[model samples]
Target: MRRPFEQLPRSLSPLPGEDLHGFVLRLAHRLDLTPIVLLRHTGLIDPHRHSAPARRMFMLEKDELAAFCTTTGMSPQDAQALTFKPHVDSYPPVATALLGLRGLSPAPRGVFPVWLLTTSTRYCPSCLAGDGSAIQQRHGGPWKVVWRLAATFACPEHRSFLHTTCPACGLPAQRIRGRSRSLMVEPHTDPLHPSRCRNVTDPEQGPCGARLDSAHLTDNDNPSDDLLNLQHRLLRARPYGTSSALDSLAGHNRMTDLFVLAALIRATWPLTADLAPSPSLARALDHDIGRPGPAPSLRISATAQKRWDSDVFSARGTAALLAISARILNLPLPELRLELRRVIAAMPPLDDAAWGQTWLNLRRDSSPLFRHEVLQLLDQRFPRPLPTHVALPGFLLIRRRSYSPKAIPQFLPEEWAEIITAPLGHTSGRSPGKTAIRRGLAAHLIQAVTGMSLDDAGTYLGIPPAWMAAWGRFRPLEERLHGCRADLSVLFQRLTDHVADQRAVDYAARRKRFANWTLPESDLQRIVENYPGRRRLLARGSQRGARMRVGFSALVWSQLTGSEWRLAPDLQPLPVEGVAMVDAGVIHQLQGRNPDHQPFYTYLHDLLPDYASTVLEGEDHQ
Candidate 1:
């Protein structure tokens, strides 16, 4: 279907890591020709373009590539190895998302998949300098496809992080030089062609036409050998399998997948905010073996936001994430398991529906251990066949009566010190460390003073209340009761005073309303509309009918009053006994009649207004 190139004047041998575009540019420079002429001679022009070819040189079709290789004295295998096409085809997730097709979709020509890869190029100065050592290598540096990977922060050979932009001019490395006519003012038309350095402030004099390979590594920049080793291992290692069984998470787009999992873990851990080490492990994410790369910048992604996930990581951040993940993965299996369990256990309980929905996406994951750990957590929290019998209501009252003490036990100063200092053996892996023991002890003391049950208090204060119960057995009964009541009387007195003062206010408000008693228009409207049959009785101006006007419905008022108040033909009549003055007791009784309002009376003492004011203020304020 396609033919080879007609002929060529000259061609250079393909360099290692050289992409198709780089190879083409290098060949053209060798022949003293422009990239446009070289591409045209090889039949690589985009058919739809009006001026110069619009398509990038990297977006070469198979036929166009064959023609170019045939003319350049290069092999098809060499071309495939250097290009990004093969790498994109091999990664299924990238292909599916970027290409919008799966399984049988061949990559279409001239369609640049920017989503799958970054357009910004990065290069290693040391490697570039190595390429410049020989006179023949001056045209271009040996650029690797791996250099384009966002995760590949460090250069394996150089042991230093790759540079994306020029430190002097802030111009990004590998930027196309010949995009517009203005950019073409100096030496080239194709922006893909790198020109001399454009930075005027660069101390190195001359036209700034220095090769990118000649860039220098600063003396203070320390290189990481461990990161370099890891990078090489990642490049050489296969995804599906490795010698260590712990390495099974490796798969297609393994680096990206690993970074995603780490982010997911960070999101799911609830207490990570509080338990996070001072300054966060995230701050030091890029510090690989003492060498730090650029600071990580996490940007929110629209797609992830729709799914309610964290912001997407920048390329440098992704590299840091990968570095962090690599360190985590390198830990021994037991240690890793322990750390994971700690994280899961530290999360506060979530509701069934929410937890299930959050975990649903991760359920079908390929990694058995990861899936098992998460599922096992859910299983432990809400096991199958939930308990049917509800706990007894008024548990505190029941406990007080059942365990009424003739004498309660208390601890001595020495024993109290021991309880405060000693560990309460196996506190659900959530035990506070020695550094936080004082805070933890204070929480436990507060719990004990409040009379909280063992399990609830233990979980809250991170101290075993059950253990305290056992310790109390050895103390004297009188001492224990004394300790329990020592700080309670003042609190109880304040609470009683507060309730009495509130009741007095309620009474005063009621008396004022009674003094100005009149059936408001709103109350009349409600009664008339609700009981249309009683309208005639209301309009009759009967003495009994006027008293029927009350805040509550007839049913509730009648139920509260019983034999105290009578009903006329209107259904509810005003009280005859307390005609002149309003009764606050009647209002209270009316409010208490509703089932929803019943709970408010549980803590209040039943006292009349006159007596309540005397008890609250030492004597009546009026």
Candidate 2:
């Protein structure tokens, strides 16, 4: 069992926005003790453990933080603010939920995401030199929490890029190697300055205790204003104020978009060369592009290559990539698609498969707006013969803010068929079967728009998947459609325009309003008197008469709603008897036009507009 911690006789006040690891170092330095001793004394780390705590040291558990507060006389809120917990929502990389963990528990195997700078941090020398306060002068200065984020590259206050490694020893500052058992470098070393380099040069030579805050140690290179601005925007707690394009996105989504865009920019390097904001950036990009491999041997392992691909550690490389990504993200939808196409066109022919992989990754990782743009580009590039897995274009899948599947009937309506078939233009009798093509087109549209499997969409539409599959085997629909791309494009545009302008009919609305409605018996009786020849066939007061009435009612319902006769209410229960009667009635009306019901369809279509208007006007009076 653990013992309660007692208040420390001497301790430094916690600095604002300082990380937990940095606080531990500063407190240890103030008391002339090593970080490991301080941690053990506070009961934050187990004194008996042989290995470094296998979780991120910055993320503390509730009890651990309570113990630290109890021992140091600090408030719980102040101690809690030291961890990345508050920023998790705005910063995705620090979100442990992404790693499938809960609360402040460390990740298994210490395997954090590469996007987080858990093992090392970038630092500005001037910030580490303190603010001339007595306490700061004694302990150097606060090591900030934001410097641990890979997205943060430059120090806005100092107007320079953060140094990645110690200038004296050439090792990443405060890095905890595999052999170490604590967060601090040289954990047991005493009498060492908190701002000095403590990384061991040799087992015999001890630690390289070089001052990190000295003026001579700072890097001479100055950062561009644009880079500094980008860094400032990224570091702001609320990023919505940065730009209009970013204001529309939530904090998490905005950061996600930026990260995804950066990934894409890096994945296709020189192809995105023209997107760089400055010549220096373009030259840096060219240098990386020229030498594809990092080592002199011209070979790179997959892990190393992945690291290089997501290289946020290098200040110049990350700045160049992120600057280009931000510019691209700020583009409007049409230009965004065009820019993606331009980059894709510049890709090497041999890397077609690579581009495909990148697209798949984008599909998984991109924000909704970015995903929509990619989908639009995909629709234009591969307009026809799309894979079953791919989603159809948004225009094809939706209209008037409603799902297309609900609006489309099982069979193509006569007016829609005319619009689609008008473009084929007498293909010398070589055109596919008109009935098969129309039905196939309906099924294909449903499948593509809903992103369902071929079999699933067919089943949903009451068409057998095997039948459509067999038809495609005999004469692939794609081959025929591919030849008429130009005509089809124009035809599609015409259909879009027609649908937009047509206000006389809303089949989906009619279907919903009349889902359970049937023609009144008074109207049916009056209509029966006109058809004396079929009067006995539709006689009332018998089982046969009841089925006949239901069948005819279904016919009227189908006509009014523009749905397939098979989809009318109460038809599913009497599939055999009801359907037979409905079929006979249709044939009687068509008069030997077995497959063409245009005459009857035209009569109903011509009558519907006035009937709908009368019904609505009467309802308004009521």
Candidate 3:
């Protein structure tokens, strides 16, 4: 635990559950906890508060404490093995009071002391490790903590400082992190060690907008500042650098620079004037069929390729070239392309159109850290939309890398508006405010355009993804069977050794595969597969033949849900719910006493005279 939080730059950024630790530390300092403690308490450490050393590290809510001990199967008596004293002498009145100071408020004013533990210098010796926190607000269960760093009282540290690596051409944040790291370095890189790459120029709190000079490089031809270089370096280190071999990711070493590598890549572009992928990038990949990664042979989804082209090479442009050489060391071009594929795969799975539009946003020169010329060029080619999806991952990615959240607006084409209604990822609890807004609006638009019910509109607007996980948890494996029989059959044959023998693979493969199957047979085959047995699977027959069709699979749920339930934006059926109600429309699609039925609100009007105020029109009407 590094003390005087300012000394360590790495301790500043937050880890998943560590935000609480940092908050307490910063708060303690801010509240002048040291003064009262210096006079009254020996140290903040309480010998009686926790039974174990680890338990003492974090602050838990009252209920949480009970749960923790219960979950861990330690009786309160055994748990009493730790200390419980507040050590109020070392903490300020506010700090002490917040932590159950006896004389102040009747109840402890603060939430769990998770912030201080998370920010402890002991864990990381870089920067203060705290999530973005708002000033003390009224206490409620739903408070959100922001994760960006902020400057207090004319931060001198805000100014950019020269470091060994260039932000543009450096290894991913996961690899060689020290402290004071960029907000948007590649994920799975390093937990940022802030000052390690402190800004050379800054007003504090945002992008420094520095211009490139030859001095940024150590040796002009070096590729030591990049991720690929680091990986290769670790490769040379054997068991020491191996995954299980090393205790921590940072224990490994590397010196590649990605920026210069990109420069080399661009210079060799248009390989042989073909306008195809460059040879230098191609040779880097190791896609020899069953290899760890695909070879120089490009097989990443077109959509993924488009996103990649927009993110790294195309969007970042010449500026990105600065970091490429440092990242990729001994690899050839094909391997590098394969590396790009890996990066794309690692990134969250968002739609291609959204990714493209976000890329189009990169062309703007809204900030000096990026190339305005490129943004201009992109604008000329892929004009902005009327209104864009505000909660895009691209925005988050850019903000972190550019070191300025505001830079996102500049990169955004005129079309994209800030999503104020809901946040991007409610599940993670990170994204908040205005994310669901767009989907909600789309539902309305579909209603107007297709004359579909609000429920149907929302369903149409939010269909299950074809192959990957989508927003809703519902799985649509069945529909996929018919639509992609050839692909599925090929995959099954390759895996099952033709054990689930497919006599025919056709559009009606689902029907054909299950043609001769009697009722109550091949349940596993029915699931985990579709058209491979299409002759049998898709063979729709009477109730007796199909054995009383029961629970409609997610494919049917996806279609029916959108067609029926997404009638309005106000209600959204989250991923997991145990019940399904069936009504007349559903009966027409599948002949069964299906459960997903709910009375249309229209009847309530007649049942209750004052229904005008309580019962909505379309809702009550059958």
Best by lDDT, which number?
Answer: 2
Error of 1 at 99 (Å): 7.6
Full ranking by lDDT: 2, 1, 3
TM-scores for all predictions: 0.44, 0.56, 0.19
Candidate 2, residue 277: Cα displacement in angstroms equals 3.8
Per-residue C-alpha lDDT of model 2 across residues 312-382, encoded as one tens digit per residue:
44565566777787777777767877787775454333223332323333443345566666556556656
Q: What overall lDDT, based on C-alpha atoms, would model 1 receive against the true structure?
A: 0.39
lDDT tens digits, residue span 1-622, model 3:
3122112112122222223323223233333442122111212223232111223332343543454343334344433322222322121221222433112212334322211211111111112222234421211011011111100001112121112223543421112122211112121112222213222232344322222222232322222233233323332321112354432112211111222123223333322122112333232221111133211111222232322221121111211232343333334556645544333333333334323333322321012212232233334433443223322211111111111111111011111212211122112221212223333333323332234444444344433232112322111222222322122212211322221232321212322222222213244235314323223333455443232232222213222222222221112343243123432233323322224433321221122233222222332363
Residue by residue across 318-382, what tens digits does model 1's lDDT show?
34444545655555767656655665565535432222223322322224444455456546754
Q: Which ranges of candidate 1 are over 4 A from the true structure? A: 1-4, 47-60, 86-101, 104-116, 130-136, 176-211, 237-250, 253-256, 265-319, 332-622
Q: Estimate every model's Cα lDDT from 0 to 1.
A: 0.39, 0.58, 0.25
Comparing 1 with 2 on lDDT, the higher-scoring candidate is 2
What ranking emerges by TM-score with the best candidate at the front? 2, 1, 3
Which 10 consecutive positions of candidate 1 have the poorest summed lDDT? Answer: 392-401
